[model samples]
Target: MRIPLIAGNWKMNGSLALIEDFGNAFSRTSFLSNAIDIAVIPPFLYLANADEAFEGTPVQIGAQTLYGEASGAFTGAVSASMLKEFGVHYVLVGHSERRTLFKEDDAAILAQARAAIDEGIVPILCVGETLEERDENRFDDVVLGQLDAVMKGLSEEQRRQLVVAYEPVWAIGTGRTATPEQAQEVHASLRARLRHYDENLADNMRLLYGGSMKPANAQELLSQADIDGGLIGGASLKPDDFIAICHAAG
Candidate 1:
């Protein structure tokens, strides 16, 4: 069975002091079991500190984003190799914010995923549809298009290191959430599409349901067959809520 993973996308939030506090809070909490995997993707500036804070704990440290290239003259870009040097275990790619705010295309996201995997960091690739697409009944097309781009040029082995996150654009940080059934439907469809690419790969890949995943609704969402865990947003900032979601996964 694919192990359940609860990942917190800290986005652009948190400072060094706050990260230490968050790490302290996380370390004190008792996990449901070793069956669950927990990760936190803090801002790039805080990665080194977060990595040191989480040392020897079950919680894995990750970076919110990474440059597609290993290293270069890109003034502001953080390369995948650099993240790995800081002991980062996961990287978020194709996040809605990146796609919307920075106009990141699928090809760019694909390159970032490749770089992360090449550097031994797992990529938590985000794929989702907008409110307009959902209203027009074109959600599936949008999601599949995003997935196809990343899947392209990826070998079977490379694909296995990925964790796909379904975070409907309308739901992320909007205080809205896809119902349990709605999330399961899309997650199931995503898995079915993966099966067409490679059955064994599809079966092993972990599909997480993101978008306002909180303590109140985590249990219901986690109980769904296709919904593995969550890529939490606001709730993850709080230790209690994040831990609650992790326990729900168990």
Candidate 2:
């Protein structure tokens, strides 16, 4: 069985104060232990601070994004190597905002994931269909296409190292969530496709539900067989709520 991983994606948000606050949460609570894996994706500036703050705990520090190449003259771009230097263990690849606002394509996103994977960092690949695509009845096709674009290029070991987050574009941060059944349907399909690669790896792989997952709906969603955990957004900015969601995973 896959061990649940409840990660907080701070997006473009973080602060020294928040790191300190998180440190307190980890130290004071036994719930943040080995029962489940925990991680916080802070902004670029606070990566070191977050890593340092959570150094002695089970909670890991992750990056929201990264440049695919190891080194380049690409100004303002952070490479996976730089992230590794700061102790980043996981990264969010192809987040909706990066795909929509920044126009990052599937190939580029997978390159970033490959860079991180090459550096021994785990990549939580974000794959989902938009509202329009789902409305047009292309949900499964679109999601699998995005997933295939990345998976086909990876080795079996690299594929196993990946974590998938199925964030239906329609539900993300709109104060709406896919019902447990709705979310499970997508997760199940994703896993079924994964099974074609290697049944054992697919069964052990974690497929997270990333769209608008919060404390109120966490329990029911987590109970789904294929929905391993969450790639939390808005709720992640709130320590109590994020932790509550993690606790619910248990």
Cα error, candidate 2, residue 228 (Å): 0.6
Tens digits of per-residue lDDT, candidate 2, 1-250, equal 6889999998877778988998888767666355799989999999888888887778898999999888969999999989999999999998888998999998899899899999999999898887778779997678998888889989998998899998889776466557899999999999999887888978899999987888999999999989999999899988789888988997
Error of 2 at 67 (Å): 0.8
User: For residue 170, what is the lDDT in candidate 1?
Assistant: 75
For model 1, the superposed segments whose C-alpha errors exceed 4 Å read: 173-176
Candidate 1 lDDT over 1-250, as tens digits, reads 9899999998878788877777788788776556899998888888888888887668898888888988779998999888888999989999999999999999899999999999999999999999888889997689988998899769988999999999988765566667889999999999999998999988899999986889989998899898888999998888788888888887
TM-score of 1: 0.96
Instruction: Estimate every model's Cα lDDT from 0 to 1.
Output: 0.88, 0.88
TM-score of 2: 0.96
